[model samples]
Structures are given as C-alpha cells and as structure tokens.
Target: MASAPPAGQGQQGAAAAASPLAPSEMYRNYNFLLRLDSTEVRFTECLGLGMRIEPIRYRESGVGNVVRALPGPVAYAEVVLRYGLATTPDLWNWLKRTAEGAVVRRNVTISQLDNDGATPRINWNLYGAWPCQWSGVPFDALGREAAIEELRLAFDRLDRA
Candidate 1:
C-alpha cells in the first residue's frame, strides 16, 4: 500500500547512518585546532577572524542630494588567541623578536574539527601574519584560576576554505 523510496535513497540513508558525522551535522566551535605554519598549537579561544572594506563617499557634480558609497581599501582584523600558561616559548619568542625590530611573517590556519577531532570541517587561512601584541599571564597566589596568556596577530589577508 506504500510507495517505495526513490532510487539511491536507501543507500544514502545507510551511508549517513554509518558515518559518525553527517553532512547536516553542525560543527562545534569548541572543537578546533590552530596551526602556525607547520606547527600545531592548542588554544582555549580564538577571536576576531574578520575583515572589512572602508567605503568612500562621493557625490556627483550634478547630484545635490545623493551620495554614493564606493568601495575603498580592505582591512583585516587582528586575531586574538588565548591559552592557559605553559612552558612553550615559541609564541613568546616570536613576539619578542618582533618587538626587537625583527619581523617574521607566517601563515596561520584555524580549522574547525568534526566530532572525531581528527577531521577538519572548516578552515580559515591567515596569510603573512605576524605577532602584534602579547599579554602576559596574571599572577595571583590567592587566585584559584589557571594562568592564561593572550596573543594578538595581524595578518595581511584572510581566506575561508
């Protein structure tokens, strides 16, 4: 009395059921990894992955009441990465070299992983990135919170892949 499913529908359903993460499943933001060049670094938070275009307002000679906005230069936002304090000196060394007048740029990739943690669902690539600022972890003997360090990076371009 019931009509059969369309061709390949059963197979598709079986495949989806077998896979741990289906295409319709939304990726969790907390499951992500950061890579600077070839090295993988762990972080608690990543923010400010964005860009904006500055608009130039222009008025035609004959137009008196209308102002047109023209697209101008593009600006990429600085990305801030935070992690619990550790003995890793790579981040500190990079910031120190930059502050001492040596500029070293590297590509950074932030990938959103699936539930499996090994598969990357989304990737954001930052090109020609260099450390712009670093915040040292606050020390308090009475405090019961973990020490956290913050680093800000300035990049020339950002691409989502």
Candidate 2:
C-alpha cells in the first residue's frame, strides 16, 4: 500500500552525502590554539575575537526618503583570555613591562581546530595587541574553584589568515 519515493529523491540524497557542503561533526569549539607573538599562550577560555563593519549612509539631496548604504571600515573588539593561575612568569613579565611604560605590542594568532584538535580549520590573526588589563585570581576561604587569571588585550587590527 506504500508508494515509492519521488523520482530523483534518492539520487539527491546520495549527491548531498557526497558533497562537501554537507554538514558533518568535524567542527568543534573545545579544541583551539592560541599564540601570542612567538610564544603560545595557554588559556582555558577565550572570547571577543570578532569584528563589525559599520555602514555609511548616503541620502539624496532633494529626496527625503531614499538612502543608500555603503560599507565602512571594520572595527575589532578586544579579546579576553582566561587561564588557571600558575607559575607562568612570561606573560606577567610582559604585562609588567607594559605597565612600566614600555607599551609592548605583539601579534596574536587564534586557530580553530578540528575535532581531533590537530588540524586548524580557521585562523584569526591579531596585530599590535597589547595587554591593557590583567586580573589576579580572587581568593576565598570557602570557594572550591581553581584560581583563575584573566588578561584583556586591545588590538589595532584583526584579519582572517
């Protein structure tokens, strides 16, 4: 009493299965790599590696309703990195030098990894990034969480490379 699938439906499914555009479970967020300057920064969490392009609007001289919008320069957001407090003195030393009026700026690279955590699927390159703020781990007598250190960086430019 059941009817067969429509013509080309099975072929369509097969084609989709063979196409690269088909969705897979390859992409994941847990596996990522972070590098600052030539040294790798170990972080348990990272965020705000993104940019937004502002739009320029052009209005007609005589017409009051029509407005054309054009793309403007892109603006990048600051990045924040969080890691477990440790004996790492390299990052702290660099930050201290910046606080001492050196204003050390370095390039950073964040790479999104595949499910295996080996292959890099995408990369975000940040230029002229300097640590603007650093936060020490909070101490509490009753808290059980691990001590966390946070660093906030401001970069002049960001690109996908």
Candidate 3:
C-alpha cells in the first residue's frame, strides 16, 4: 500500500490550480491608443471612461417610513484627454472653431493595447463628442515639465465595441 502525502501538500496542489490569472495576462495600463474620426490626433492620456447609474426613489403611502429605490437611467460622464503640446495646429484649430459658435461632433475611439502593445484588446467608442473645455498646463519659470494640453468632451453616448 502507498502512504498519503503530507498534510499541506494536497491543499497546495489544489490551491495552485485554482489560483487567479496573473496581472501579466491582462493588457498593460500604459499601453493604450486614442483616435478621432475627424482628425488623426494622438493623445498621451485618456480619462473619465466611466458611467454611473442614477437611482430613483419612491415612497408609498401604505408602506412604513422606508423608501424604495430603483435603478434609473445610466448617465455617462465626460472624457478628458491630455497630450503634449505640438506644433501642428489642427486640434487647436478645431477647438477654436467650435468655441466661436460652431458646434462640431466627432466619433472617438480609445483602445486598450494587448500584451504585445500592438493588438487592440478592447475599444471604447464615443459618439457625437464635442469639446466643451480646454486647458493648458501651468507654467513655472524655474520648473521644467512637459507642456500638456487638456480637452474635455461631452459625448452623447458611450458604447463598448
């Protein structure tokens, strides 16, 4: 007859098999891409790719002091993109035109790169996005930093594709 293994060896074997996938399996946070339908503009950072569901509450006369809540519509938040200030002025021109009483909407796509940093793992598509705000990085005479430009967009909808 064969003897059983040690007390913890069997448990370790099972636990190893059930372990979660490592962070290496997912795409890196720094590897991402941003594209605009109107112009071929590259951005260094993308933020605010999230949505929240507002809750609607109601109270019934027959019920006690407690109120019932239900999930309401989903409200998409604005997306802000940051990029190093460049010489080419297409993006700035577009924003300027929009600020001068002309409204321009463009489709935007933000993709997460795969492990290889080339393939696209997932894409967030924004429809009918218009730039609502623009900001330039603060300047300091003594400090050295990259000149970053920020653009805030208000999109009609956001869909995962």
The predictions' CA RMSDs to the true structure, in order, are: 6.1, 4.3, 4.6
* Model 1 Cα RMSD, 1 decimal: 6.1
lDDT of 2: 0.87
Across 9-122, the per-residue lDDT of candidate 3 in tens digits comes to 796665655768655675787888888894546788888889999999999888878899999998889899999989988778778988998988899988888988789889
Q: Deviation in angstroms for 27 in model 2?
A: 1.5
TM, every model: 0.82, 0.81, 0.82
Over 4 Å off, model 1 = 1-24
- Candidate 2 C-alpha lDDT tens digits along 115-145: 7888888899999999999999999999999
Clashes of 2: 0
Put down candidate 1 lDDT per residue, 64-140, tens digits, no spaces: 79999999999999999999988978898899999999999999999999878889889999999999988988999
User: For model 3, what is the error of residue 61's alpha carbon versus the real structure, in angstroms, after optimal superposition?
Assistant: 3.9
Poorest stretch of ten by lDDT in candidate 3: 14-23
